[model samples]
Target: MKSFEKELPENYDALKKKANYTSSWRDRLDAVTTLSAYQHEKVIDLLNNRMKNDTVFKVQTAAYKALVAFGENVEKPTPARFDVIKGPNKIFLRVKKSLPKDHTVEEFADKLKRMRLDVYDAFEGDKGDQFMTWLEERWAKL
Candidate 1:
């Protein structure tokens, strides 16, 4: 029978770094997706870690799928109750309060990027190409 083991990618260290829970959820998701192609034991370990512990539901789901693809027995994780950015409305309201009455949405977006990079990054990752439009709509509602 042929061995199905695969070699780790050259950028494995970088992928590991991105797999850390502290990294943005999107980064972790990207790492999981990239690492899933390999059949190495180390790769399986990394994907299992993400499956069991990543706070983002999407990341967890991706990790679970990858593990299943590798023929690992695993249950689908329940969606995490933790919000990517806690109290996002409150955070944005604070930003809105700090700005001048006449501030444009662009200025608000800039301030959001500067003041709360976590929120900015989370929204950017979650919204993808719709980020700007979502921000604009959110800004108007605020």
Candidate 2:
């Protein structure tokens, strides 16, 4: 299967075309998976076409996922909710308000600290998957 490297023009073109017009769903899947690594402007349209026109549901789904990975607005992105278990000795910071996009993990922890509650472990709500993902990503570096 061709890759998505821009240095290899053939790779980009192959993926852009195969992903949209390939006869084999397997080939289409291969192209869709590689689309995320390429940064061509037209690839978005190709993926969009795959998402909407592909005969195979799997291929269509793969295109949709690729679009999302590319940061394309396939749909509205929802903010994640931070959920903490209420505590007697352990205190969870539960904010009922909307948080700014620039809110940091340090700020989150510090808020709980100021409330004089010891954090055991923080839990995230279903809505907070993106927020938790950011935290987990930072934690991996440490």
Candidate 3:
């Protein structure tokens, strides 16, 4: 098996190709994580779907980790007033509600951590044999 770093795709198309050919749990996980780094909403959507249905334990774990990394990278710091430079392929979260924009970087980091915790709480589940069975059922539908 190729190392995850060695197998990482260079672009969206490459990622898709790799995903299609992925035969090992690690390969699938690497594919999702590599695609997530691109930060494109389309890639994120694809990874999310895979995460939901991937029968491989490592692949799902990698997908979740990649999602966390994607959120952290894309979410702008608070004092910036939600002003964001959306990359050509990436999505940005817009702030609809007004709030105090005078926050230090440390505060922003803390807030990001809290937000991450909330997300984790929503997605928490056992990653055991039962989960593997669930994944297999889900994957069959996909």
RMSD of each: 3.6, 16.0, 18.2
Clashes of 3: 0
lDDT of 1 by residue, 31-100 (tens): 9998888879999999899888765667888999888888889999986455556678898999989999
Model 2: per-residue Cα lDDT at residue 55: 49
- Top of the candidates by TM-score: 1
Clash counts per candidate, in order, are 0, 4, 0
Question: Which of the predicted structures, 2 or 3, would earn the higher TM-score when compared with the native?
Answer: 2
* Order of candidate numbers by lDDT, starting with the best: 1, 2, 3
Ranking of candidates on TM-score, top first: 1, 2, 3
Write the residue-wise lDDT of candidate 2 on 71-130 in tens digits: 678853222233333332223224212234466656654554455332212222121346
For candidate 3, the 10 contiguous residues with the lowest summed lDDT are: 88-97
lDDT of candidates 1 onward, in order:
0.82, 0.54, 0.45
Off-target runs (Cα >4 Å) in candidate 2 are 1-9, 75-142
Highest lDDT model number? 1
Would you estimate the TM-scores of all the predictions? 0.68, 0.43, 0.40
In model 2, the Cα lDDT at residue 68 comes to 77
Question: In model 1, which regions exceed 4 Å deviation?
Answer: 1-11, 21-26, 40-42, 52-58, 77-83
In candidate 1, position 21 carries an lDDT of 44
